[model samples]
Target: MKVIVFDTKPYDRKYLDKENERYGFEIKYIEGKLTPDTAKLAAGYDVVCAFVNDDIGAATIDVLVDVGVRAIAMRCAGYNNVDIRHAFGKIHVVRVPKYSPFAVAEHAIALLMTLNRRIHRAYLRTRDGNFNLNGLLGFDMHGKIVGVVGTGQIGRCFIDICRGFGMQVLAYDPYPNPNAGIEYVSIDELLSRSDVVSLHCPLTAETHHLIDAKRLSLMKPNAVIVNTSRGALIDSAALIEALKDGAIGGAALDVYEEEAQYFFEDHSNDVIKDDQLTRLLSFNNVLVTSHQAFFTHEALEKIAEVTFENIANLSAFRGNRETYLANEVCYQCEKFGGDCPKKNHKNCF
Candidate 1:
């Protein structure tokens, strides 16, 4: 199978090429994102592999279909960028759902620790030969309440880490996990009570701006929020207002809502035009990291393996006319339940 990967970085190429040795698939790497304009480059390829921030929207999907691309293999877990509704019966879509939950969970804890202890600030201070300890006081994590917003693999791992710190754990999920071994509360209660709130949910229409002004108002005055999940989960403007008013404590973010344009690229020489992002960086309490929570070596290797597995599965399905591909996701199945109305179909296509 021939695959063209978009938004390729050196690390991406390195790991993907190493993994491709097993699959023996012809692969092409493109540094540019897979936008509608770039979709034509997938012509004659069996599959187009994209990353988290790539534009796999309706127009791009149409172009891929027109250019004889049969499948979209997302190297990352999130597929919110893909227009699944438009791609139904047109092309198959697959993704790497879980690629090192510990990588993201550990990164979330690192952000929380860095923000709480002001380690970033202290590092700069020490480097500048200032040894003042004033304004550097941080509370103990022990005996504090932590609200975990999602109890998926990553969220569960975070909860375990918080428990190891002797912190009380309160979780909120629409579908609570029975095996989570933690208290499940309403989102409002979690916000009002927790000293630290961590988000680990997917971005959906329902979850977009889940942490708006109203929600922020419910949080404890000294509560700190951490997000290693989708960017749009928290409203950046509302967060800024909350920070200005000191409504909550602070935020440690690994993703931004409008990060597609700036996250993966070097922009130190360029003027960052995103005013909200600029304002976010202006706050001393807020710590912003490029969307790299899932950038560990293990995670990248698994992503590459799963991505290639998805392509190989699609190739096998196409040849043998199988009923289903394990990692396949479609609008009908996602919008409804997991049950697709198209019975015994090889895929949505």
Candidate 2:
């Protein structure tokens, strides 16, 4: 099988090449993303494996389908970037639904600790021999109420880390898990009671900008916010306003709401157009990373391995047994229990 992997980061090539021989596919690593403009890159390929930043919408999918591309494999767990409904009958789309949840969850904890202890600022000060800790006082995480907005695998792992710190966990999810040490609460209650709020939910119509101005105002004056999930979950303008008004204490964002223009690129020479992000950077309380919550060594290895398998399995398919087929995600089996109960052939999952 000929596979073209777009959005070829250095780390992606490193891990993908580590187990390249096992899949035995003629792989081409492309530097650019899978946008409508770059869809022609996969002209002769059978499968295309993409990352989070790729534009795999209707137009891009049309190009891939017009060419020989059969399967679209997302290396990341989230499929929010792909237009599932539009691509279903035309082309196949597969995703790594669960990878190393600990990688992302632990990264969230790292951001919180870094923000709380002022370690980022302290490092800058020590390099210049300032050695000042005047305004760096931080409270312990023990007994602090942490509001976890989702109870998925990543969210559960995050709760595990917070519980280790002896923090009281409050969770709000459409599907609650009692096994995890999280007590399900209303979003309003969670916002009012928590010292830290972390968003782990996926981006949907109902969840998009879930943390807007009204919700932001419901939070405590000194509460910290952490988002390692989809960038669209929180309104960037609302967050900026909250930060400016001191309605919230601080924020650690792994993903930005408008990341497509800037992320995974080198723009150090140019001025960033997003003035809000620029202002956020000016403040010591805000910490931002380029959506690197899932960049752990172990997670990358698994992503590579699973992506290779997805390509191979997709190539080896005879007919309808294709795991990467758009119908498979909507094909609810007995194993799916009551979770995927949509038998209306809508592909709405």
Query: Mind giving the per-residue lDDT tens digits that candidate 1 earns over 180-211?
Result: 67899999999999999999999988999999
Candidate 1 accuracy as lDDT: 0.92
Q: Could you tell me the lDDT of residue 172 within candidate 1?
A: 97
Off by over 4 Å in 2: 321-349
Q: Over 4 Å off in model 1, which ranges?
A: 341-348
- Cα deviation in Å at residue 44, candidate 2? 1.0
Q: Candidate 1 at 93: error in angstroms?
A: 0.4
Question: Model 2, residue 52: what's the lDDT?
Answer: 87
lDDT of 1 at 194: 97
What tens digits encode model 2's per-residue C-alpha lDDT throughout 1-349?
8889999988889999987978678989999889998998899988888888899989999999998788898898877788876786677677777779999999999999999999998888899999888878787999999999999989989998999999999999988886665689999899999999999988876889999999999999989999999899999989988998999889999998789788878899999989877987888789998899998899999888888777776766637442333323332432254364544333433
What TM-score would each prediction reach against the true structure?
0.97, 0.93
lDDT (0 to 1) per candidate: 0.92, 0.85
